[model samples]
Target: MTSTLFRALLAVLVVGLLVGQSDAWRRRRRRRRCPNPTDALSGAQTAWDATFMFECPGAQVIRRIRSAHCNTVEDRVWRFECGTVPGVSRFDEAFWSAWLNEYNGVMNFQCPFNAIVTGFRSEHRGNDRKWKLKCSKVNGMTTFNHAQSNYANEFDLPGDYTVPSGYYLRGMHSFHDGRRGDRRYQYQICLIDLP
Candidate 1:
């Protein structure tokens, strides 16, 4: 009877260990698929360096790339230095250009403020579209003022635009003058964080 009881206890102990290990593995897998702010910015050690790093609320890890675009997956922030922005396919770009042109190069898009600006893609792609800074903040809101003429080839704004308080920069898009069929004119999209 003593030996049998001992064997039973051993089996239970082994089963418990296995169950605990399994649960731990599952937690790890889930973390990899969905990381919080802490996980996304895990290795950041300093404040904004005025070049790559920027100050983000509750972000434990922060990184930046000068001439690249941000590619977010799960809790990881990756960079792509290729021609067009990573994750944005060529098909999507063509569609956007055509649509922006039709709409007089005026568009407004917003995203959540969960992730701050890690980098920006300023390289002009097709349709002779380029980055332009119309305006940054207007009455506590980020606004993109459409230019009267879409013929400007490059950024001709008065100065660099900065994000206002409680706001963050997301991304940018270009829209050509859809009315005149002019490839030289396009609306420079300024994507911002939604309230």
Candidate 2:
């Protein structure tokens, strides 16, 4: 009777360990399936307002100046652009002005910059509105460059500039701002490249 009881206790112990291990394995799988969104950014001091990062699918190539342009793709739900330069120091003030455009109320850049030197301008035509985000290098300065447009206007814009150390180029755009209105769209450009 004693031997039989001992065998029964051993079986119970084995079954308990298996159940516990199975639960742990399940938790690990779940974590892998849905990783933390910020895990993609290597040097973020603050959390991004939005969750669920869009997969930026693109390839980087080396090319001469004035030879390539950063292009974006627009699907039914999102629009995005991304490009990479061989060196971060390649970007300069002239390159910003020549490559990036500031017309009406939209500013475009061929690659990410270290900062925004000027405030953004917003222009509107009927139901369509455009918000221009300028790039800069100096810190702690707030100024505007464009005149007031007849369209809807917004000034004093701030954004993530000054590329963090040990990072590179990335840009993203999405139409789903997770809002409940017609203005539920967002555009993002950054210089956080992680391995």
lDDT of 1 by residue, 131-179 (tens): 2221122222333432222332322211123333322344333444433
**Window of ten residues with lowest summed lDDT in model 1:** 89-98
- Clashing pairs for model 1 are 41-60, 41-61, 101-178, 150-185, 175-186, 175-187, 176-186
TM value for model 1: 0.23
lDDT of each: 0.30, 0.30
In order, what is each prediction's RMSD in angstroms?
18.0, 16.4
Candidate 1 local Cα displacement, residue 51, angstroms: 31
- The lDDT of model 1 is 0.30
lDDT of 2 by residue, 1-195 (tens): 999999999999999999999999998877645223234333322222221222222222111101010111100111123334333332233112332222222343322344422222233233223443334332332222222112111121122232222333222121221122123222233333221
